[model samples]
Target: MTAGGARRGNTRFVVAGLFVAFVLAGFVSGYASSHPDGLEKVAEEKGFLGQADDHAFANWPLADYAVSGIGNERLAGGVAGVIGVSIAFVVGGLLVFGAVRLRSRGPGRASAPTGDRGPDDPGPGGPGGVGTDAAGAGAAPAA
Candidate 1:
């Protein structure tokens, strides 16, 4: 396919993926099992669950898979899930942007490399080069 068609296809794929992610985060997460999983179940079965301490971030707003201050349990969990997904998406995008910017400039390069032209020089097409002028056609002769 052409470049524009490929780009549009990629965009549609990304949009569909994002839509699925949002739906899962904001809806399906509420249906997740409330019972403790294998590890937690084993701890409880061994009678050591009481001795376990809460996690360091246990008091955070999004802790325990639920958002704080929301009355409905399922709704709170769904909101927390969506918020978590959004935060992760934003952080990932920023990291990709930074990496692309650095790669475009090459290693140890801080600025783009320009042609070796001085202030008084008309190196390319001599005095009337290919650049726009006051009339927006060709470069004007230097004073």
Candidate 2:
């Protein structure tokens, strides 16, 4: 791992992935299919579109993919999209980072070793996949 805590050479990949995702979400998504998405289309085809229940928070700001009170529809949609993307990225990153940190610390560590690949770690076969025994002693290779 690097001094910043991210695994060595992984920070670049993560940053690039995030950049690509944000670009796709913020800009490219505007050109996506305008036809009702799966659920809405299904509802319409099923003749239940009129019976669709109203969203409880439909009046909330940034609801229905548009920012409330924004005069320009296009700008409002873009702003709301960007905001949603940013929030999702931040929340997802925090959750993932927290989970990884928590998992890396292990269960009730009592002066555990600093390096990764602990003895309890599973092998390439994964948990109980023939090769990965509880003791981490891999099964013998097939002839």
Candidate 3:
């Protein structure tokens, strides 16, 4: 496909993905169970739940899967989920951009190291590293 076509397709894909992410984070997350997860359940069953200390960021605004100062539990959770998803998307995009930028700034690389071979060096193809064979007829096209 053409570069423009490929870019348009990628854009569409990203838009669809973001739409789904936002929907799930802002709406579907509200229906998620509030019960303890496996780790918490296991601790509770083992009678060690009370021994667990609060997380370092337990007092953070988005801690406990809910945003602080929100009266509605579902809304608070939804808002937190959306915030988390948005933050993750932005962070991931930044990482990809940084990686691409770094790679572009590095030295250029060729598919094959053509410089190592001396001017007189006959490649694996014998005679001419490229072009015609010894038989006279054009080389049966490189693989």
Candidate 4:
């Protein structure tokens, strides 16, 4: 339990949250509210609902709530939601992992266990400062 892991949250909690998303996507999505959401309902009331056309990406395979060929709307929507949830989970996890790894490996870190003496701190050959001779002068190190 390092500092980073605590900030990120427990693994069990993360897995549980993802499982809940999967369940909702695979099952509860079929029962999602049928009425037009707030924006669509407002547009319809304002007499401009027809102005809204299909999404620009409508031709995509999962274009509509349902798959292209799936006749059963409920099943299609549920399946689509489940797939979307899985993809989101994987992508999100990968992004988090990459960020943490990059942060740890970034230049601010030091190879020595003492860790992060900062740019101004004299590196090894102590007190010479960078690119300097051991006498702490602004001269190159002696061969």
Q: Which number leads on lDDT?
A: 3
lDDT of 4 by residue, 42-125 (tens): 999999999988888888878766776788888888888888998887787787876554334225454557756677444555
C-alpha TM-score for every candidate: 0.60, 0.61, 0.65, 0.59
* Comparison by TM-score, 2 against 3, better one: 3
Task: In candidate 2, list every pair of residues with a backbone clash.
Answer: none
Residues 1-143, candidate 2, lDDT per residue (tens digit)? 22334465577777787788777766777677788989989999999999978899988997888888989876777778878878987787787766555333223564557766757643253554423332233222221
Where does candidate 2 stray beyond 4 Å?
1-5, 107-143
- Over all chains combined, what TM-score does candidate 2 have? 0.61
Candidate 2, residue 112: Cα displacement in angstroms equals 15
Question: For candidate 3, lDDT tens digit of each residue in 90-113?
Answer: 898887766444333213442445
Give the true-structure RMSD of model 1: 14.4
- Report how far residue 48 has shifted in candidate 1, in Å: 4.2
Report lDDT (CA) for all predictions.
0.70, 0.67, 0.73, 0.69
Best-matching candidate per TM-score:
3
Query: Against the true structure, candidate 3 has what lDDT?
Result: 0.73
Model 3 scores worst on lDDT over the 10 consecutive residues at 134-143
RMSD of each: 14.4, 10.3, 14.3, 10.9
